[model samples]
Target: MPNAAPAPGQQPAAPLLGIGQVLARLTTEFPDLTPSKLRFLEERGLVHPARTPSGYRKFSQNDLSRLKLILTMQRDCYLPLAVIKDYLADVDAGLNPPMPGAALPGGASILQTGRRLSREELTREAGATPMLVQDAFSASVITPAETYGEDSLIVLKALVELQRSGIEPRHLRGFRQAAERELGLIESALMPVARRRDPSSRVKAAELAVEIAGQLEVVRSSLIRSALSRIVP
Candidate 1:
């Protein structure tokens, strides 16, 4: 459960860290973190650090932990801030909600433990051959990278399974085209937000893009399921 706010007329607990100290502690893990980004997260209501007498922000231990979880989810899971905010709301309410983008409840915490893998390690871990990985790259299914993250590993593993059903990476080339079309739709939807020249607007636009993509996924999955039902019946 999350820490409760102090009652009226009560001061927050001692030993809170200022924004600079918090940055010092977290910058190594999150190299892109900046004071403005921290402020942006606060503005998004992901963290509610207490205020000092002079109106400065002071983060408690709980605030620091929450920030870490939020950042980890963003970095590892690529989840939208809205989704993460909803998941954290459940946690604060004392519910054991499943992590977003995870396959199952109680599967893993939002904090990922896996490191990026080289091409060889990626194929080995996915039980796929180098040829298949190359095909995925050729088909634009997976971006060519010197080191692959968990998302690439998951895609390669799925491709390996699909291969057993005689579906090769080349057979899925249309998926890349479909993704490009969906991206076009997202970009169109974000045009108004993108027209703004402010940094916060850019942040909002990015989050909105992910949320739109998630909605598109839901529609795409439903269409697939509907099509499958006709064939299976």
Candidate 2:
């Protein structure tokens, strides 16, 4: 994590953020944001909203902007929190986010901003039960998130439909393996840039990993289901 900001030039200290203000600001964008979840992000080093004399957090406008960027990447891009943390690290250092677009070196567009969804909203929209969603995580099909993004909801929704046809979360455990293999490929491909330790490159590496993994999942699931169909009644 970055070092704490120098005490604002010794000027009069700014007001701290109470729970309600923090909730009110973040809730509009991250509807599932709770005090626990915010604390979790802080614990992970993703955000460092300043603390007041009473220890209440006081998020500056910059803090709010950074939070928006992080949530956008998570929900829209399906990036794991670790990767998102790396990207934000770049931003904090005044470096551009590494992703597809003219902003970074790679010509890929995979790092575009995206919308996110809350867990409850995702379950309801995807017509999935909470148990099934939890099972996905338990089976290593999906990771836990403070708020699931749209892609996650879409995947869960599709899985729910598949479950109706007798496919279980355990059946998709291979998906995790297939995904790891694809990530291995992307990592190798990006090693030249990734080895430099540039925050932008790291972000790019992460974005590429997610994009390829998503594609690999689609193909692997389709091929397996198709092959099974021939033997099944």
Task: Flag regions of model 1 displaced more than 4 Å.
Answer: 1-114
* Position 109, candidate 2: lDDT: 44
TM-score each candidate: 0.56, 0.42
Local distance difference test, candidate 1: 0.85
**Poorest stretch of ten by lDDT in candidate 1:** 105-114
lDDT of each: 0.85, 0.72
Candidate topping lDDT? 1
Q: Work out how many backbone clashes candidate 1 has.
A: 0
Error of 1 at 181 (Å): 0.4
* Residue lDDT tens for model 1, 40-155: 67866789999989999999999999999988777666677776898899999999987776644467544353367999999999999999999999999999987887778989
Q: What residue pairs clash in candidate 1, if any at all?
A: none
Candidate 2 stretches with Cα past 4 Å from truth are: 1-114, 197-233
lDDT, model 2, position 48: 89
Whole-model lDDT for model 2 versus the true structure?
A: 0.72
